[model samples]
Target: MTPETVIGFARSAIEITLLLSLPMLAVSLVVGVVLSVLQAATQIQEMTLTFVPKLVAMFIAIILAFPWLMDKMVGFTRDILLNLPKYIQ
Candidate 1:
């Protein structure tokens, strides 16, 4: 209802988003760096060399982290729903 409340909600949403994406982002970053280093060492300058591995790693990360991600998302949704009346007031 208030600007401060809106800002708080926005901040919470952003934090949740970042938290949810962290696993995949981290995996992708690490995979990319490692692949880049390997490519450099092997002198295999293939532009698409990192794509499949990064994708697979990201997918695996998402799958492995799915339960935790879902739990966090559900908790956030529950909190928002529980506080909806206060927000409306």
Candidate 2:
């Protein structure tokens, strides 16, 4: 571990984290925005009205996206494991 090698590993870890998280974050964001718009249009300011739809949508998205998420995680893990010797120094 030279500094550049450490930095590269850190960058890869960050990128993998972001890639893994993006699906859920994006789904939540889009669902929240859409629900907020609908709530505004209906003037249903119940406050708690927002939670159910977003939660359900995110849950459904996660369920549907689970395989792809798993594959990404597995690939990242494989890469890290394969590169262990490089980090060992």
Best candidate per TM-score, number?
1
Q: List the residue pairs that clash in candidate 1.
A: none
Q: What's the lDDT for all of these models?
A: 0.96, 0.88
Which regions of candidate 1 deviate over 4 angstroms? none
lDDT of 2 by residue, 31-87 (tens): 889888998899888767788877888889889889999999899899989989978
The residue-by-residue lDDT of candidate 1 on 1-89, one tens digit each, is 99999999999999999999899999999999999999989999887798989989999998999999999999999999999999999
Residue-level error in angstroms, candidate 1, position 14: 0.5
What TM-score, to 2 decimals, does candidate 1 have? 0.97
RMSD of each candidate relative to the true structure: 0.6, 1.1
